[model samples]
Target: MLTGNGGHLQHLCAQCTSCDEHAPSLPPESIVQMPEQNTPSGRSSQICSDRRQCIHGISRQTNWVVRSSSLPQRHHIYKISNHFDPIFKLEAPDQISTDGGTNLASEEMEAFFRRWLVKVHLSSAQYPESNGRAEAAVKSAKGLLQENTSKGGALESDKMAWRQHASHGDQRVASCVTGYLQLKEWTNTSGIDRGYGKNNVKILHVRREGVVHSIKEYEINTQLTLNNDKDYIFGDNSDIIATDSQKNTVYILAKKHGIVSPEDFALLLCTHFLSKYPYVEKAKIDVDAYPWRRIVSEGKAHNHAFLFSPEIQHTCTVSQRRGGSAAINGLTGMRVLKTTQSAFVNFVDDEFRSLPDMKDRIFSTIITASWQYNTVDGVDFGKIWANVYKLVIDKFAGNPDTGIFSPSVQNTIYLLQKAALDEIPEISKISVTMPNKHYYTVDLSKFPEVGSLENNEVFLPMDKPAGNITAVLGRATKSKL
Candidate 1:
């Protein structure tokens, strides 16, 4: 039994054997008396009257008693009926006391509730055994919230309405839209960026209008960093409108600005998104331009005709942040061959050294050259790329200064980079990957009448077990390459 002021019965303890008629009723037979040796000297401890009602096998029933004189006249009291209910009742402090003196306000009550809810939720997750009801309630609440917020659900309309409301909710979510331009007309003579085709026969077909119907199929992938307060965007909202608009913008820009090199076009795209969208903080634009070469007619480049060449492609990936420098990377395919200049020798000889050292051997490689520009502004990417391509081919084929002589692929790639960097000052670094396409000379020793194959004119092209060589070159101070 718990007693209040003036000896009033406030609560009937579960272990109480009997209660007065005025007090709450209790079952007398449920009371269990503890062993006398276990009792404390000054304090009284009671066990749960009903064995089935015990929690975690602990029988003690803790009681809290508030004296009537301690509470104000206006103070409210709430009783919890069962263990499933909230353990404590909350009361908002009154602004004025009964004596007309200043008291705590209702704002404190709101703060108290917020802190209490956070503590309850955190404790329920961290220590579920301490408050099973709180844990169960938290799980139920989460499931209910998800059910109300899921797309196409019954509460979807309300959730969306709340997200759109200015004072009610917030929207912040990231989205990416990828699109491909199947066919877009690009007139090269528009004078926007005229150095797209310099000293290359491929440019001859793109110089005239409608001559190259589908010169390059551009695949554009743009990601916009959106600004939302709570980072919650409705699933069915117009958050993807910007992405869809970017797809259309690609075609429109291609038709209007004319497709130059992939780097130039990618720069235009980065500029468009950063300038157009006020909410977009950064834009990442990646473009892959598929190559298309014109079918030659009697050794002449055909007009209004083209063939898709999937063997090679030009790629440009540009990342533009608001008020930041743009990072641009460009890559293209180039194949070069020199029948008697390349060699492989002086390598480590181990148990796996089955390959014989050769001072002079045929070199053929499909080169994929990638380079980075120092800056995108005011740079003639088309001209620089053309010069770089020519320099790579010339160096691979050997020049007058470095004639076609015996050397390793490593030496050849280094010289290739050195020559390109010497001519193109705008290029900060260049990376070249050359895979060795081996062509083995055939032997005719068994055939006596066929004569000896001394010159080794006849050969068999070996696809597997070929050597791979790669290297990157930059200025003396540039170590990142």
Candidate 2:
């Protein structure tokens, strides 16, 4: 339903293709007559022609049309793309004029337009003027209003007022900015950077040598740093050229020098931006390395066949400053479980204490551990990570000498932390979080003869309402778990 300036209502059919073919055939009862003071003095034929043309022109563009519905002083534009699509609507109170002299606030109008763009999925347009369909629709709507004003009638004043209202442009200004990146795989190393890829790079230990998969994900955003520069604010884009060059540098460096750990890869990326671009004082790079393990079949590892492993994911963050200072963090995930040596007991009695005491129960936890390196110099990150991870698992599952008799999850995690810090001295601090997965004993009270229930072995595993235990451990200080 489309409402005109004089409170006249018309049912605009979306299937109508042409005004001459559909306007005269519409039933008389479908159109609502305007009030005496607001009715136009033009002939009935001209009014019907203008109304049908406005509706027909909108439906022909992009297979979508938006119609306004009257609601007191507020007006809403509901847009539909197709018969199967949902209706997208936006309120325009300032677009309507009433006798009470009420209008929408400036903030309200801006928010309404923002929400409209998101609803119609038009906010991602790289160039707004490139949308020719929307431009054509605006032009058609404006021409329809101007034609109505030319017809002298009782609605001449109202028509002229609406023409002026539609002619005015929005007072607010908006800008849409975007940042993009690309990814590619590179192989074959030539030169050496830190004494890894040497002259024997032609035939190394593995035939599929160099990097298992030398692929990196990168993104560069300089909007915040350049927002205040006069050259950038006024549309000078020399800074954007610098950002695009960073993408090329990632491939060039990876092809020249072999791929190492994520920390090293991220550090190389950050160093390039700070050294090459004088305007870019600081740069942050984040990298994650996915592990691919060789498949073992018939007691031997395959040469080219590999399987993706989610057991451990390597992540690193490097922040480079203009003063030549950097910070790096190494993180990974480890899943460990013990079936017969974990317990939870000794808590204050309360109404929610429906759980029974147990001395032995299955304990399972997925641990996420992060360690900050004191210094990257002379440090073998791959070796240290493998050793530290093995130590953590060994402490959780226990060995033949120690046995598995954990009093609580907290105690087990503390021991795991202490073991990692004791063997790996390069790490300054370590943090671990363990979520307690419950495995409850199945109840068989309804059964007639099932021997003693205390000795029952059946159990039911639960995934929710689990306990969460976290701790941060260091060589010199201790924290709560």
Candidate 3:
């Protein structure tokens, strides 16, 4: 039964009438009158009712009722990991915080329980009346998680176990529980950019392609203090042309001159590289120009572009990775570090997970710079350096996200870069490279596959690609570590 925003119960018939002393009122489309008390089947919470005055045994109404009746129950699950705590708290403090606190504070007891209660009112599933029942479930969950971790199962295993135990009843209840659990899991585990964290990444390579341009300019005819007491006169005129990845169209001169900096020059190069390309929303510039200098004549700096010898080589790279669940990568490889002070511990245990000692030191990172802007306006080198400097030092000393870390070098790099981008607001994205070394073990077994165990084939090579690949994520840079 339903009413306008609320409910309105009318009169109830004291006795059931079998078409006696009652003119058979036409069976209305729906029933609005209250149930009579004498009937075997009184209004047992109105299986289905509307405001009309008809009483039908059953009717097909909204699909929701049918769907609810056929739904399967689900139990909500969550993680209690080292990195899980800080990420839910500090990563996006503004967005994640509720109730005026940085911690993962819940609004009410129900709110807290609701996250794990998939089928809240399932007819078959039991509801925990006291904290003890919840605690017992948690203990079991923790054990399961620990077991999974010890067996090297992924975090998803923990969540899946909870889901498998949820109720299977009506569709409505099942859907509600499924949605609630998923939301809670995602909210808890999803990084700033969906579920991707540094652990989900691979490599970041930043490259500065080439700049193309031609210049014709005048030389400085200045009288300077020379060894021969002669006026040091530089060339009076010059003309040159060059091209590279960026076809920086250069005007000879005498036209409108634009203010240029290191960043500006870099942008010019990027503009040329991307102008004729396809599917590029924008280009990120990286200026790894070999250090070049101009002559100082008569106490004035001469205006000249630094040129590298054709025989020598310099390197820079730019890339992008964008999708809802995909990583955002642009430029990487500026600064990276692991602090000696951080630690990991007290993670939730499950059937397939394990927990390390809380006191054991865990690694953290301060990724230096994100990607350089490949544009003429110029990158804020000052800002880039500032972020790099601060993160390199601060990430180690302060709390860093611990969830994403692993003993593997790849995991560390990914997590650090992710943190750098996530923690720092300015940096938009990062690209990264991680190397994995294969440690080979001597085959002591007399026979090959016949006697060999699962991990018996120990082979370690520093130059191998065992899941080590470059990752290019965007929306990284200039952010605090």
Candidate 4:
């Protein structure tokens, strides 16, 4: 089956990210080659028409054949409001576009979409024909990708040149689909960070005797991956770290490091792994820090009290190879909105453009700023984080009494990144991802008394079909957003 990239659905991002759990699947019970005739299989166009006539007989099943889900993402998307979504733990998209397959084109599907507040766009019959049956093409591409291992340069042969034009969506979707292998199916990680040892994760809390796991519930999560030549090349557990040791080290390290910030803690973990083991040539660490604020009671803050803050989160990722410098990256999520002083105007217009040019409108966004630090030693990460956080919000709203004008989100991102680089030398570069959260003025033309959102001050906020704007600014080159 050709699985399309689910990038538009933000919830799928986590599922697509690489994890050791999706390691190389064991060899299937049976491996069957493509049939000589290339005859179409009746099993959704894959299996033979008659089970008894087939060579494998009635015992044959899909799990018997070697398979790969490395399919290219079509320009369009398919969304069904069926058990497929809820079983996958999705928040569901605001709209769905699909090929007019018999399964998708039905009153029940339309009713489900409408009841769930989902917009449905059905692709024309011709579109599906143009897309065509891609299973053979996908299988060919997957074979080529697996066979070639030339250190990732330009493809040498003319036959492979077409991959240069393949969209990133195609490559990403193919790489990450092998998640949680089936009991009898075979799969591989597509030569991306393969691991064979036990991989364990820990959520920090005082795990000592008489200490409830949720007492502190700091909500800090950490994962460590160590690599060396022995385990990977020799196929022995020589350099492998035990599961118990990993859990113990995580707890002990938390007590030693005191959890200053995610960046610092992640860096510390990376460095320790590199230093402690001679076999560990490379160490990568990921840490997520959640917000917990001390409770304030009666004009004073409680020392031993706190409340879980779920609005925003901080993430730190650190990686280092032995005898190499460490790379530290941090991300912060913040939400801010302004009622006025924002406008989006004069955009390139075509037949699809229906939005009238906006002016002095309400603009809001969930800000995700990703930055890499050039220097980590003797740096005050806490203070720098605070300053940068304040700076972005302050820049978003200039002269608090009356905010500054924002002509476009692109310009605002560029300005803030530029300002941040100017403000802090420790940061090497900054990339800002801000999705346009829209608030449309309630039309009062029916009443004929509100005077076009002037007399009646009311608006409706939307959470879907958000505009995505992102750019990176660096010391070496200032990117044009």
Q: How high is each candidate's TM-score? A: 0.53, 0.50, 0.25, 0.54
Q: Rank the models by lDDT, top first.
A: 4, 1, 2, 3
Q: Candidate 2's residue-wise lDDT over 1-481, tens digit each? A: 1112221112222322332222222122212232333222211110001111121112221211123222222322222122112222212111211112112223443354355332111211343332332333334444444455544533454443333222112210000000000000001111211110011111111233544422333222221122113232233344433444555566676666646666776667667666775645456665656566778889987666778777877666666666653444444666666778777788667998887788778888778777777676777777887877776767787676666678888898788788878888888878888887777877776564964556447778785988889998877755676
Per-residue CA lDDT of model 3 for 1-481, tens digit only, reads: 1111111111111121211122112222232344343433332221211112111111111111110111012211133223233322222111110122212222442354244321122111132222122222223334444544634556655344334323334211212221122222312322322110011111112222344233322111101011110011222111111221122222211123432333443334334434443322234333333323445578865554434332211223332222111111132333333433334455567787753444423242223233433331234544554465455344333345542234444445555566666765555556555433333344547677576644433543333434344565566237586
Best by lDDT: 4
Which residue pairs show backbone clashes in model 4?
A: 41-47
Ten contiguous residues minimizing lDDT sum, candidate 3: 221-230
TM-score of 3: 0.25
Model 1's TM-score against the true structure: 0.53
- Write down the worst ten-residue block by lDDT for model 4: 48-57
Write candidate 4's Cα lDDT for 373-437 as tens digits: 88778878777777777778777888879878899999889888998899999989888999988
The per-candidate count of clashes, in order, stands at 2, 2, 81, 1
| Root-mean-square deviation of candidate 3 | 28.5
Error of 3 at 406 (Å): 4.6
Q: Highest TM-score, which number?
A: 4
Per-residue lDDT tens digits of candidate 1, residues 262-356? 77777787788778866555677777776777888999887767788765567767777777646455555655567777788889999989889
Q: Report the C-alpha displacement of residue 370, candidate 3, in angstroms.
A: 4.9
Q: Higher-TM-score candidate among 3 and 4?
A: 4
